[model samples]
Target: MAEKNYYDILGVKKDASDADIKKRYRKLVRQFHPDVSDDPDADNKIAEINNAYETIRDKDKRAEYDAMLDNPFASQGGAGGFGGQSAGGQSGFRWEDMKDQFGDGEAFGGGGFRFDDIFSAFGRGARGSAGAQSSGTSGGFDQFGGGFGAQDSKGQDQHAEISVDLASVYSGDDYSIKLNVPVRKPNGSVDYENKTLKIKIPKGITDGKQIRLAGQGAAGHGGGKNGDLFLKVKITHSDNIRLEGADVYQTLNIAPWEAALGDKVNVTTPTGTLGVSIPKNSKSGSNLRLKGKGIPAKHTGDLYLTLNIVNPEVNTDEAKQAYEQLKQAFADTSIHR
Candidate 1:
């Protein structure tokens, strides 16, 4: 079978301009983005799109790829292919040299845009597999996608992102994930099996930190050890909360009188509910720092309460009169200098 064409994958013509290519790429990405797409193969489609765009988007790489397409036999030697002799009865090319170029899946850079970036853009995490191969040519399929040869080699490691709730980070919790993993059959054939594994989220685990699972990645060949799986943690929080390292900032709503006169109010925090005092004459957007009340790490972190004053509606006559009286009281106070 012929190799997949990059242009066909991106739905673009060979003579298409850069702008056209970029526009097509964006359209395809939106159509196949896992978050919104209903396609079952959206994940694989995205990987193919990213790989094709990364190559064709670059001028130098595109030129090199075009040359290869124009002369398909140049790299494999004129007429001489992998088997034994050339099509023009010349000679067989060196299999070792071809293996050096395409084997081990490093030739194409393993998909430039990683899966983590795709899912992170949607404010979530993703689980998927790529280039997962088994040891040996079990099912008559070689590790390099050809029927040429087989050898004992360790499988490649896999990476994915996992979303962890802020509450879960405050207190460690257990989570489970399902994946389609390679299972090496006793007959030496490789089979993809759905498996579930439970993961532990440690307390105070920050975003971008990875958790490694041994022997949970692609299966190895010829008694080689299986590759490990790495899960990068992404800490997720509500819109009202923002985190800066170990410090947590949350919006605290208070009344107008509470801001003018000191008052105590209860706040429901990640740790628990606590009564906090609203300082007298406090303004909106003021931060109240509670030391060592953020994430419960070794050093601990601080929690900041940003005050947001909200006013009650003055629809009732009594309410309107009260507001009028208050307005008269503060009429002489200059808000702006």
Candidate 2:
């Protein structure tokens, strides 16, 4: 069989840009993640996406994989992989004929199976002078080119990115997430198992920080402890709010008169709406600070309101006359400061 195409798995073309690939990958992760999704195949789907992403995300790895995709013998294990034995049959030893001769535990000791045993059994010499590379019982390939099963080996830790909106960060609530894990079959094949977990998102959490779940990663080979799952938080922000650490900034638009004469106005904050006083003769771009009003945590953050003065349109004659008078009054005034 041909090796799977990483690009196709992510629903992207070979020419897709890095940004485009990231967009698609994020969408798929959210779709198949077991903690939040209801689909039974979500775990397998996500695992596929993760594998594709890890392979194609690197420039050198992608180039190497692309070259392999064009090669005829790429899947047959290249030079070292058994690749199902159809290629090695030209020398009178058909790989298909050995189906009844070898079993997993029949040839090798308790460590693991080796492909070299097959070559030795047939007296055709080993696959290579180096012999079959043993992966201990933990992870190396078998002599017949089979892959490692769980074998009680500790599962590997898995990583994923989770995107959260600003509201969730402010609330610091517990969230449920879903994921699919790989389960090794008796025949050495692997299958996906979906799982969901309730996790707590730390309040005042910043982007790029990670939260860890114990025993939530890939299953161990046999009775080995499951690996941990680490989630890197990606906080998605909107144009309406700018968040930095505990500091929150928002641009507040106000009438010109309000800035010149001053007034108490209600301002919306991450916590809630609060009435704040605008100082008299305030200029546009003035900052109104509300201490300890941004995010609620051990160390509270402040909210900074940037004032933007807006002049009303002079469409009516009365408004035009008022503007003309104001212009005349200030025309000779030395307000250059």
- Per-candidate RMSD vs. true structure? 14.6, 11.4
Off by over 4 Å in 1: 1-150, 186-189
Give me candidate 1's TM-score against the actual structure. Answer: 0.56
lDDT of 1 by residue, 82-173 (tens): 12121222232232334455554233567665434433342221122111123212212222332221224345477888999988989999
What TM-scores do the predictions have? Answer: 0.56, 0.53
lDDT of 2 by residue, 16-57 (tens): 988998899989877877767898776566655654665566
Model 1 clash pairs are 79-86, 79-87, 80-86, 135-221
Candidate that scores best on lDDT: 1
Clashes of each: 4, 17
